[model samples]
Target: MDARDRDGPDRDGREADFTWGQARDFANQLIQAHSGKHLTDLEIKVLQGSWQNHTYEAMAEQYTYGAGYLNRDVGNALWKKLSQALGEKVSKTNFREALRRAWWQQGRSVPSVPPSVPPSVRPSVLPMTPPLPAVPLAETPFAEGPVAPQSPFYVVRSQVEDLGLRSLLKPGALVRVKAPSLMGKTSFLYYLLQGVQLQGYATIYLDLGSIDRDILTDLGKLLRWLCARVSRQLKIPNRLEEFWDSDIFGSNDNCTAYFEEYLLQEVPQPVVLGLDNVDRLFPHGAVVEDFFGLLRSWHERARISTLWQQLRLVLMHSTDVYIPLDYNQSPFNTGVPIELVEFSPDQIQALALLHHCSLDRPALAQLMAAIGGHPYLVRRALYELGTGSQTLGQLLATAATETGIYGAHLRRQWLLLQQNPALWQALIQVVQGTEPVSLSPLTLYKLHSMGLIHRHNNRVMPRCTVYRDYFRSMHRADSP
Candidate 1:
C-alpha cells in the first residue's frame, strides 16, 4: 500500500481512541493562532468528551461540572469559537462528522470517534464525586459532610459581607481572613474558591498546619518545600534548581522570582493560593516575617505588573497576634481583612432547619445562648440532635462537662492552655471574674488566639458561657 492508502485506516483508528490530551493540543493551537485565545481546562475536557460521542450530561458527569453549565455555557462558547476558526457551524451533536469534514478539506486526519451510544440511548450517569442518595434534607445533615458552596446548610446572606472576595479575582489581589478557630474561616474560603472554580480558575488550598515541623523549624527548607508543593498542586513541573539561589539571593526572593517567572507561566488562568492556619508560621520568627514579607511584595507587585495579577492570595489565620514585621512589609496589615464571627441566632435557626432539627425559635435562642453560635459547636449540636443521638437539653447539659458532647474539643483547648501556664492562669482570672479581667497583653493575645477568650480594649473574659462554666469549675477545683 502506498503512503496515502496505508495512512487512512490508521488515522481513523487513532480518531476512534481520540483523547483529551490530543484534543487539547489541537484546540489550543487552532484557537490561539486564530482568535489569540486558549481553551481553558474545562473547555478541553468538554471537547474530548464531546468528540467521544458523549452528551453534555455524560460530559458533565465525567468532568464533575453541571450539565446545564457544560451544555449551555461552555459547549455553546466552544462551538462558537470553533465555528469562528473552522469557518463553519459546529456543535457537540455532529462534532465528529464536522471535524472529519473540516480535516479532509484541510488535508488532515479525520479524528473520527469511538463506538458509543447515541445521545437518545445514553443512560443517565452520576458524577465522579459520589453523591448522597436522595433523603429528607434534614436527615442528611449539612454538618455531617463537606459542605458544597451551594449547600443549603452553608449560609451566605449577602455578598457585601465577603469584602468583594467573590468579585476580586484579579492577579495579586490579596484577601486576609482572620478569625478564631471554628468560626467558619475555612468554610468561607471554600465558598470563595468554589466561585472561582465556576469561572475556570486554578486554586491551591494549603493548610500550614499540615506542614511538617521539620520544615517549619528551618527557613530555607520551608520555602523550598512550599515552592515544590505549590508547583506540584498546580501540576506544573518543578524547576527548583533553576529558581533557587540561596547563596546569592535570599530564599524569599528566590521563591518569589520562581513563582513570577516559571510557575505563573504554566497556569492557564488566574490562581487563588489559600494559606490556611497562618498562625502555624507565627512561632518561626525570621521565617514567618520574611515569608509574610514575600506575600506582601507579591500583592504589591500586582499593582505594577500585569503578570503578577494572576497570583491572588487568600490567607486565613486564627488570631490577631502577629509577628512584628514592618507594617509596610506585612500582608496582614494591608489588603481586605475578613473576620468571621459565630453564627447569629437567625443563622443558627437556619442551620437547625438545614440539619432537620425540630427546634422552635426559643429553643434555638437557648442553644445560641449556650454555645454562642460558634459554627463548629452549633453544627455538632445540630448534627447530634437531628440524628437523635442527643436531645438539645442533653447537649447543653454535657457541653460544659468533661464527658460532654464537646469533651474532645474542650480537652484539646484545655491541654493547649496547660502547655502555657501564664495563658491558663489568665484564662482562670477571666473565667472566674464577674466581668472581664485585665491580663498582660501577651497573655490576653494568647487566650484570644486560642478562641477561648474574648478581648476588648484592655480587658478579657471567657469567650462564651461554656468556656466560663467549664474553666470556672476547673480553676476553682485545681491548685491555686
Candidate 2:
C-alpha cells in the first residue's frame, strides 16, 4: 500500500526476492493488458532475458539453442505477440524500449540503460542546397527557374561554356554525356539551352524517353515532331503550322530534307538540338541513321549570308551509344565523352551545410561509409537529418535500416550477390581473408561501381559495417 512496503525487506535480513518468475508474470500481465496477448512460458522467459539486456547470442547460449533458432523462434515470436498486443507490429530493435516502458508503468526498474547515441550520427556543415524544385509529373510547360551561374545548373553551364560546346554546336557535332539517373542531365541541358539562347541560337529539346518506338519508325513523323519542338522552344511563330501545311509532311525523305534545308538551316539564329535519352533511338537503326545523315548534310550544305557561329548538339544518355559519324567510323566514338562520377566527401559536406546540418569530418566519414558519397543518397540522408525530429543517433540508425536509401542500396547489392552466387562467394572470401582480397578486374570493377565494395591496398573490401555484417550474418553456414 505504502511506497516502500511492496519493495521493503521482511524480518529475515534478506532483501525482497525478485524471482525470474515474478518478472515473467509481470511481463505477461502487461502484455495481456496493453497488447491483448497471452505470453507463454518461453515467450515470458525471452522477454525477461531481453529486459535484462542480454544479446541474442547470449540468450541463445543460455537457452541451449542456435542463434538463428533463437532469433526466429523467440525473437520473432515476441514481435508477433507484441504486435498483436499493441495493434501494430513492433520492430525487434525497439522491443527493449517497449518492454522497459511497460515495466516502468508498473513501478519496476529497468534492467539496464540503453547505449548512448551511435557513432554514425554527425552534423553537416555544407553550403549550396539543391536548387531545382520538384516538378509535378502532370505539369505542362514546366516552369523555368533562374539560369544563372552558381545555380543548380552551374555544372552544365560550366561544361558548355568552359568546354566551348557552343562553338562546336553543329548538326554533325554529336555531344555525349554519361551519368547515372538523377545526376542533373536535364539541368545540364537547360544550362546548355541558356547558352544557345544567349548566342541567338534556335534549340530543340527532344525527350527521346517520352517518344514511342513506333514513332521513330515513321521518319517523317519524327522530323515533323522535331521541327515542332524546335519551333516551340525558339518561339518561331507559324513555323510548325507552316510545316504541317506543306507537302513535305507526307514524305519521310522530303520532310527530313525540309527540316534540314529550311527549318534548321534558314533560321535567323544558329540552331542547337538537345536530345535526352538519345540511346533509346538505337533500336531503330534505319531511322537513327537517316536522322543523323540529314543533320550531317545540313551542316555541310546549309549556306546563308551570315554563317551561324555554332550548331550545338547536346546528347544525353546513361550508357554508351555507338553512332556512326563517318563512312569508316561511328558517330558515338567521335564526340567528347564526359563521365559523371559520384560526389566527393567534400561535396557531400557542402550539400549538408547547405541544408543547415552539421556535417563535421566524423559525420562525413560516417555518411560516406554508409553511402559512399552517392549524390542522391547523401542528399536524402542529409534531408532526413535536416527535417527529422529524432536525435542524430536515431536518424543514423534509421538510415542504416533497410527502409532508407542507404539500406535500399545495400539491399540492391545483396540481391545482386544472390543472383550471382560466384560473386557472393568471392565477396565472402575477400571479407574473411586474413589479407585484403585480390579480386579479378571484372569483379572488382562491378563491386566498386555498385558502391558495395571499395579498393584498399589494391584489394577489394566491404564499404561499410552494414555490408560486412550482412555478409557475416549470411555466412553462418560457411563460417567456421
**Which candidate leads in lDDT?**
1
For residue 28, what is the lDDT in candidate 1?
50
- Candidate with maximal TM-score: 1
Model 2 regions more than 4 Å off = 1-161, 164-173, 216-220, 237-256, 282-309, 320-331, 389-392, 398-401, 406-480
Candidate 2: count the clashes. Answer: 18
Clashing residue pairs in candidate 1 (N, C-alpha, C atoms within 3 angstroms): 171-309, 171-310
**lDDT of predicted model 1:** 0.70
lDDT of each: 0.70, 0.55
TM-score of each: 0.65, 0.52
lDDT of 1 by residue, 1-480 (tens): 343222222353443333333344445545655775556556766876775566888887776789999989889999999888777887877555555444444423222322475645432321111111123754465454335555545655343333545445555788888876667777787878766665778989888888899988788888898899899999888899988988999888889889988998888799988887887887667778788888898889888988898888888886633423222333358787777777766566556655666565467657877778778888888888878888888888889989898887887777767766766777787877897788877666666766787776688777788888998777777867
TM-score for predicted model 2 compared with the true structure:
0.52
94-151 per-residue lDDT for model 2 (tens digits): 5544443444443332221223645354223322222122222232111132223224
Q: Give the TM-score of candidate 1.
A: 0.65
